[model samples]
Target: MSILSALTLSRRPATGFVIVGIFWGGFAAHVPVLKAQLGASDALFGLLLLGTAAGLVSSMWLAPRLDRTLGARGMQVAALALALAWLFPGHMSVQVLFFVSLIFVGGASGLLDVTMNARVSDLEAQTGRSLMNANHAIFSVAYAVAALISGVTREAGIPPGWVFTGFSVVTILLLPVLRMAPAAVEPEVGYAGAYPLWPILLSGLVVLVAFMSEATVEAWSALHVERTLGGGAVQGALGPTMLGITMAVGRFSGQVVAERLREVPVIVGASLLSACGVILAAVAPVPALAYIGFGIFGLGVSVVAPMGLALVGKLVAPHLRTEAISRAAVMGFSGFFFAPVFMGLVSELFGLRAAFGGVALLALCAVPLALALGRYPLRTAQIRP
Candidate 1:
């Protein structure tokens, strides 16, 4: 399907993606300020972010059930929750409180993440169109826009609290568009079948690796530009802005690529390209070169998680899609939270450059996981006598 058609088919979920992206992009651009406010060392800051990891894991586990219970209003409820949750972190100056605030932020984000992705998968199944990449591209576009705006706000000396509050209002305003259609009922099968654990596990692992690499950049690229390369606040914000913009371009291109290429080859090639980009970013001596590296990395890694999630939807039974996706998301989304900790510890010991190198290594690991997916059997054993 064309990108426009795919977007239209999954517009509600796409809006959810945009909401999530806007919050994260703005937060990412403000990471330097947040860390400074807490007076946190790299190690301590990483540990604090573990609060988010805890919340994300717990909420993701509950997502399928929550989605079922909320039905058509799932997205709206989740979005509103996230809007409120984000308000705490920016307003907090205490380390403990900041950590606590992240927990709420992470939980709300995880809830929305699973719900929206599942919604997109449902649309893809219903329409027989590959919509995952298109919907995710909307997220990348929104993220880039938010990052730029946040940068401008930061330059104007606006505090993160007001910036977050503004974005929260924007999210609340979009609530109406997040209403989903009622999910169609599935036909009952004669016997309960074993869940397709293998595909979900494999796809989840691929997504985990992809997100780990992606998150490392989102969380630390600004620091790399500002502290490591001696850039100003606007320049630091540009780090993630560059990544978001390139990722949008990459994901939009991936929509077309998905129509023509096999999944395994595409993932494998993209992983290698991302690895190269990370290595270059790690080694770059100047902010401009680092931006180039980030751009290249964003272009390559943009499609990996979306494709991984799409693979799970394609491999699992329709009746189990929501549960399967929730399980996979728990695994995948953990990477998003854990990565900051990983980078922080590494940065504390070795420096941001070495931490980025570690990310490059993580990117390369996706190749083998993608190959495993290629060899896995296609027939999902959804039922057994």
Candidate 2:
């Protein structure tokens, strides 16, 4: 299908994911600007980020319950909340306010993340099609574009707050777009049933490993290229930049293949691909080779989380779908939460190559987890919108 047709087929979740991508992409690029504006040290900013992680984890825990209570409206409110909360960080003058604002920002984002995934899962059930990967690909695209623009604007000396304020309008526009979506039905599965605990747990672990691997490369690839391989700044930038581009491409490819292939093989193949990429990067003698490995790693590991979540959506009782997803999301977010520390500790003890090798080992772990998940029985009755 054409891109426009695919997007039109899945407009609601697509818009939500893209908006999130834009918000975060801008936030990522403008972080240094925000820190400079507030005059915070690296240690202080690190602590403030910890607050964001805490809020995100806490909100992941809360999202299912919130969804149960508010149904479809919860997603709309959470998306808007994420946009509004995003505006606070760039404008904060006080350290305390900056930290507090991030808490709410993370909370809102976590909520929106889970809700959107749940809705996409519901949509999948309704349509009998695979959409998780395409939805996520749009997110990456928005993130890339927004980050690039943020960089350009920063170079031109635009204030971070004004940039973010302008971006917030994108989320606000989503309010009307989402409102125009067909009215939501009561989920075919009711909310009071017991979730299949072990299957969800295993699936969540797979997601955790996937995210951890991706975050490791994203956080440390440049340093690995520069410090380890003695590459110049431009070459160093190429590591993460290529990884980001390949990740989006890989995910888009996953969307194309997700429906054609069974979930287990896709998960296993992607994990192994990521494993090879990281391992190759670990052993590369030159910066150029390492960049290739990082790109390979990005392409291979890209499909892991989306496939896992899609599986969880298929396996769980409809009533408990949101909760199951939130549980897995918390696990996935934990990877994002600890990846820096994990990379730092490993690099400190064994060096960057060893740290990346360790990431390779982590990626390998997902293969078995994916196999284990394949043993779970899917629900006989599917939920449809």
After superposition, the stretches of candidate 2 with alpha carbons farther than 4 Å from their true spots are 2-5, 30-48, 91-98, 157-162, 180-194, 220-240, 280-291, 347-354
**Scored by CA lDDT, what does every candidate get?**
0.89, 0.78
Local error of candidate 2 at residue 68 (angstroms): 3.5
User: 1-385 in candidate 2: lDDT tens per residue?
Assistant: 7344556767887878888778776765665566567786544554556657777889999887787777657768888888889888888888888879988888988888888888788777777778888888787777667766766776777888888888888788777665322224355534565558897899899889997787677656766777789975445556666676677888889988886888898999998899999999999999989978988998898889888888887788766677788899898877866765667667766788998999999999998898998887777435545
Q: Which is the leading candidate under TM-score?
A: 1
- Enumerate residue pairs that collide in model 2: 190-319
Q: What are the per-model numbers of colliding residue pairs?
A: 0, 1
List pairs with backbone clashes in candidate 1: none
Residue-wise C-alpha lDDT for candidate 1, range 98-192, written one tens digit per residue: 98999999999999999999888887777666788888889999999999899999999999999999989999999999999545736446737
RMSD of each candidate relative to the true structure: 2.6, 3.7
